[model samples]
Target: MTTIKQDTDIPRTLQGLDDDRSSVRLRAALAAGTTPDARFVDKLIERSAIEPEFFVRDMLTWALTRHPVSLTLPALLRELRSQGAQARSQALHTLSKIGDRQAWPSITRALLSDGDDDVARSAWRAAVILVPEGEEAGLAAVLATQLGRGERETQLSLSRALVELGDAVMPALRAASTASDRRVRAHALATERLLHDPDAGFEFAIEEAKRVVALGGSGQEG
Candidate 1:
């Protein structure tokens, strides 16, 4: 168990960033994120340039993840505007992990025009998961559009997210099972029993229950 020490000295932690060893600087960024100070937020953004290590930058993301996602997302979006692909990629991966639906609109905008297929798929999936509860039709529309354009992995991710969306997704799920692509239809069928069989839902509800001593709890053995 790696217990993080509350770094009482800010100057000392900053000095660690200057160490000749890259690992030392990475650990410093990781520790600084957990600090009670907001100033470290600016420092992380600055170090984003001076630090050449991807792992270090990823650690910086992990540190930023500690803050309220609202504060970090706008900055990450700005990073996406730059020509540097690594920063844009790392930012998207970070946003996806935070999993906040509040960023759905931005994710949707990214998916709508992103030239890269992977980035579009990731943002599309994130948008589906983030849409507010009252917005199933909207979620389904976006999801269906993505399914229409997506590769196998994107469709699978959409299917799983739809399963989480529950009954609100049945209409779309039913439609997906009828898509022109056999692969899409097959993925839709993976979730079919839940839509048609009420007993299937009940079985899943207590799937972890102990083996029945007698089927249907009968008074007599079978």
Candidate 2:
């Protein structure tokens, strides 16, 4: 393969994405999106998986969104099966941004409950976006299984995804509230609180739930 030197030539755009400097790579991603080139689609998806910088990864997502879904969608779906967690996570993130319902089937329960927290969080957000109509309840039940799975940020992501499913998640939340595990019960209570009071902060709800659970209570009271 011919090496793409760092220059203004359009042919070197893919190489620009791999530039040693973060700024150049950022601009390369930005330019790819601005131009919406099919030739750049594969390069962008490739870069997204390993991009160390958060902002650049975001821009790569934006670039993928700019391309035709017919092209980007298949590439992203393939990435979901990749052994690399970041590849799966970034692909899920891009798919969520794309908002293509066709990608819904790929958001498997395994991905939602992935051992890697970042991949799981990304899967949660993507699943909420790609869940088919009338399947919210089922998705909620699946998501509910992951209660108390991670730290505050991960729990918050799960809560927000469940909240996005609306009343469909209530049954799962109620069941989880009575779980033998205090962590699961607390998270469930906090999620229920957020559902009833959208204005409530997750931290406040979680802390309150913890207090209630500490008292050997169910934490289901209003």
- Give per-candidate clash totals: 0, 0
TM-scores for the candidates? 0.59, 0.94
Q: Write candidate 1's Cα lDDT for 87-194 as tens digits.
A: 555566667667776666666554533666645555555655667779866576556544434554554455555665667777775676556665455445554443
Q: Clash pairs of candidate 2?
A: none
For 175-199, candidate 2 gives per-residue lDDT tens digits of 9989999999999999999998999
lDDT of 1 at 222: 36
lDDT of 2: 0.92
Evaluated at residue 96, the lDDT of candidate 2 is 95
lDDT of candidates 1 onward, in order:
0.59, 0.92
lDDT of 2 at 191: 94
Error of 2 at 122 (Å): 0.5
Spell out the clash pairs found in candidate 1: none
Best by TM-score: 2
Root-mean-square deviation of every model: 10.5, 3.5
